[model samples]
Target: MSAAFDYHLVLQSASKLDHALELVWSDGKTSTFHYLWLRDNCPTTLHPDTKERTFDLLSVSADIEPLSFSVDNDRLMIEWSEGDHHSQFSGEWLREHAYAGDLRPANKPRARSWDAQFLKDMGSASFNDLTTDDAALYSWMKQLDQDGIILVKDMPATEQALDDVAHRIDYQRQTNFGVTFEVRSEPNPINLAYTALALPLHTDLPNQETPPGYQFLHCLANDTQGGESVFADGLRVLEDMREQAPEHFELLATVAIPFRFHDETHDIQHHHPMINLDHQGNIVELKYNAHIASVFDLPEAVMHDYYLAYRDLMGRMRQAKYRMQYRLKAGEMVVFDNRRVLHGRTEFEPTGHRHLRGCYVDRTEFQSRLRVLARQHD
Candidate 1:
């Protein structure tokens, strides 16, 4: 049967439910209303409120019956009782409120994968061959998008090179912790030390209201024995969580855990979910930092469950299946999207000197450059 003839609706003229009344709309185009849905969502008594007071439709009597309805121009005038109490609704409004089309499921957008074409498009130029032009930088960024990390080999090992690389993108994010540091004196405790230490896999600046959009680190000197930076695509970790521990994934998605970073110089904290998702529940970002996570404030029962789930998720994150490990050599700079990728380092002995200068740039500017380059190529 055709959809138009599949459903039927009845409307009565009288307010009393017991009254025998004529049906106004025999054509199946009009929507059928459940008595309870109309009564609770009715326009007049339970009308959409301004900020005056909150209303709970769930607490109202579900048994309360809807008496009748009439057509007044484009509106459906509803009468709930023999008394003159009435509610008016536009047909367009009713259609919007009542219709649930198809109810069939669809697949989410698949994450982009890396391939040879992506690598070639990134421009296979050695660091000596790199230039400060739109085409070269765009190719480099496309490479980063494909591989989650890219190395610009043999860049001039100078502070000016760091500035040049950062400025290649149109927009730069000037953090209080702007690049180029040496192991001279005590910087902020939160500032990443140049000394050799195995930093945990994490997305940076979780304490900020909106963390730095992107990060660029230039390898000034990597003569130290072993200080390899490791990168893991946060999106991959989320996909694994979705498959192996759906409940834990759901818990992380729904709950907001707190993060804090404090020292003599700075104190900041905020609550954000680990797996950030879009309104449609597609995973968009990951915010994971073990050292900065504050003690969660929840009920004892919920807290216990949360700890177990958080631990399991972290264990999965640390696995080799999701990681891409590489070391930055001198004159090579790596730029990555802070919101989508987590980065860390393997410790090297502090006996030898190792130094890297870094800075931040807004992601919108980076994407804008990419589009401009793509247009030029087009």
Candidate 2:
């Protein structure tokens, strides 16, 4: 049958459980909804005036039983014996929360690993109309989701342009340094980024409770030599480590290492596993910083194992097969995921001058903007 005419949505079967109900749809999809879930989500559970749930689940017995169930008028109706309450559920909601036997949400894409091959495969777009054009913004945001980084060309070198671009999807996330900051080779700098040195690939602000989601670097001038921007996919490195040494990967993922940044003015500290995982045990975030990583409080034997895993992870990060190198010119900016992609630079000689303006944006706002754009287009 043709796709449009192949529509089939009907209750094929209904079964009751001790505390739940299972329904099979005509499409051969089965969904199980708990009794408590049905009671909490019932339309009448809400206060008519306040529009908030008036039903107190705690007042209901845990052994609440459904007296009868029937599929009528394209809805599944269940009548509970207690309080004589009836619930009519739309099949659409049941399909959405279907437990595909996985603990995590099914739609979320697991992290994809990439390496030096990504250098040629990275996406790029124009900075000229990103703020004004919805299509342009959506395209760039999708690129960031797919590749974890994207380069924009021909932007105005003004700080306003940087702010405009960052604000295109979301407002700037302010830090102790400020909403935005500058990077340059200067005297008595607070961070090593202020000086000319080869910085190993690392995430930014790992010392914070929750690090900023994204980092934007806008190059205003690049008259200096040898300061090439470098990137490495931490997800790729973790995949290789898990394949070569599963035990080391487990150590990095389970051991909570403390990171700190302290000076005369500020002292920031955060403890997080270098390799973070989600409920489904998928790599979600990578936290690493060689500069500010604090001493281990772990026992001597455990510390030895952690050091081996730590040093091995760093060595793998430096492998040529997993690194991407790109040098930004004037009027160019690159935005990257600070959590998943490790970024750094090769040491540069200060022949004349080089400068870049940078800022941070939370991931929530960035993804929200893209979803809104998608809905509008749909």
Error of 2 at 366 (Å): 1.8
lDDT of 1 by residue, 1-378 (tens): 123322333322223332222223334333345556565566654435563324355555555454656675556676765344566766545544543222112434444533223333332345544554566666677766554556676778777876676676655676546444332212233334555468889988777766776687777777666678887777777777788889888888878888998878778888887877887777767788898898888766678788888999889778877667777777777777787778888877655556777777776776777788778753
lDDT of 2 by residue, 215-300 (tens): 99999988777888999988888888989999999999988889999888899998888888878777878988899898778767
Backbone atom clashes (below 3 Å) for every candidate:
0, 0
The parts of candidate 1 lying over 4 Å away from their true place are: 1-131, 179-196, 299-301
lDDT, candidates in the order shown:
0.65, 0.82
User: TM-score of the candidate numbered 2?
Assistant: 0.90
What residue runs in model 2 are displaced by over 4 Å at the alpha carbon?
A: 1-7, 27-29, 44-55, 100-111, 186-194
RMSD of each: 10.5, 3.4
